[model samples]
Target: MEKEIYSLRSQFEIGLVTDTLVMLLDRGARVPLIADMPQVIPMLRGLLEGGLRHRHVYCRDTDGVYTEVVVFKERYDLELIESASQIRHFNRVLAKDSTL
Candidate 1:
C-alpha cells in the first residue's frame, strides 16, 4: 500500500508571548519548538505593551480576499526597514473603527 501524504492548513494562527518565550497555535495544535530568535520575544513584548503597532492591508482576488500584515522596524530617524529574522505575519488586525 502506498502511503499518502497530507497537508494541513490552519484556519487561525495565534502567538502567545511572554518575557522569555513565544508560543504558536495552529491547526488546533500548540507549536512550541520555534527557533530561539533573540529579537522575537522582545518585539512581541513591545507589541503587547503598546510600544509597537501592527498595520494591515487587504487585497482582493478573483477567488476571495486576504489580509497582509505589514511588519517593519523604524529607526530613530523614522526610516522603516525590514529585519531579516523578524516575523512576516500576525494573525490579528486592528479595525479602523475600533475604539481601543
Candidate 2:
C-alpha cells in the first residue's frame, strides 16, 4: 500500500489521475496506496474503506479503469509520501466565481 494524500479539509479540491483512496482513520487520514501505474485498481479497493470515507477518482480507460482516492480529514497517518495527486489549484478561483 502507498500513501498519496493527507490532511485534506472540507474545502479541499484536487485533480486526481491515478488509482487512489484516502481513509479518515482514528489517527488521521491515509491513502493506503496510489498505484505507480493505474492498472492496480483492484488491488487497492479492499483497503480503501478501512472504516473511513474513501473518495475514489477514476476514468474509464480503453481496456479497463484508472482511479485515484482522496480521504478527508485534518492529518495523514503515513510518514513518507512517495507520490501525490495534483492538488486543485483552483479552489480560490472557483470560490470567487461562485460569488458572482
Candidate 3:
C-alpha cells in the first residue's frame, strides 16, 4: 500500500492558503484520488493542527524557488475550495481587460 500511495502522490499537489486553509490540486488526467484516500485527510489535519514540529511539504513559491511550506488543512469540505485552473483563468481575463 505504501508503494501505491507513493505513486499516487505524483498525481496531486498541495498548497497552503493560510494557517487554517489548504488547496489540493490534481496534476493527473485520472479522476482525483482525494475521494479514494480517506485516511490521508485526518493525517493531514493532524499534521496541520499539531503545529510546526511536524514535517512540511516542499513547494515552489511565486518566485519559482522551492521552500518548505507548513500546510494547515482545517477545511475538509472540497466544495468550498476553488480549483487552480479557475483562478488562473480569472487572472488571465483580468489582465487582458486591464490592458484595454
Q: Highest TM-score: which candidate?
A: 3
Models ranked on lDDT: 3, 2, 1
The lDDT values for all models are 0.29, 0.30, 0.41
Give candidate 3's whole-model lDDT.
0.41
2 versus 3: better TM-score goes to: 3
Ranking by TM-score: 3, 1, 2
- Candidate 1 lDDT by residue in tens digits, 1-100: 2222211331222233334333333223232212212333344446455533442212211222232223355321111224333223322321211223
- Candidate 3, residue 78: the lDDT equals 31
Best by lDDT: 3
lDDT of 3 by residue, 41-98 (tens): 5555565665433443333323323322343554333332146665564345434644
Candidate 3 clashes between residue pairs 3 or more apart in a chain or in different chains? none
**Which digits, one per residue and each the tens of the lDDT, describe model 2 over residues 14-36?**
22222333322211224222322
Model 3 TM-score (2 dp): 0.37
Segments of candidate 2 deviating more than 4 angstroms: 1-38, 50-54, 58-100
Give TM per candidate: 0.20, 0.19, 0.37
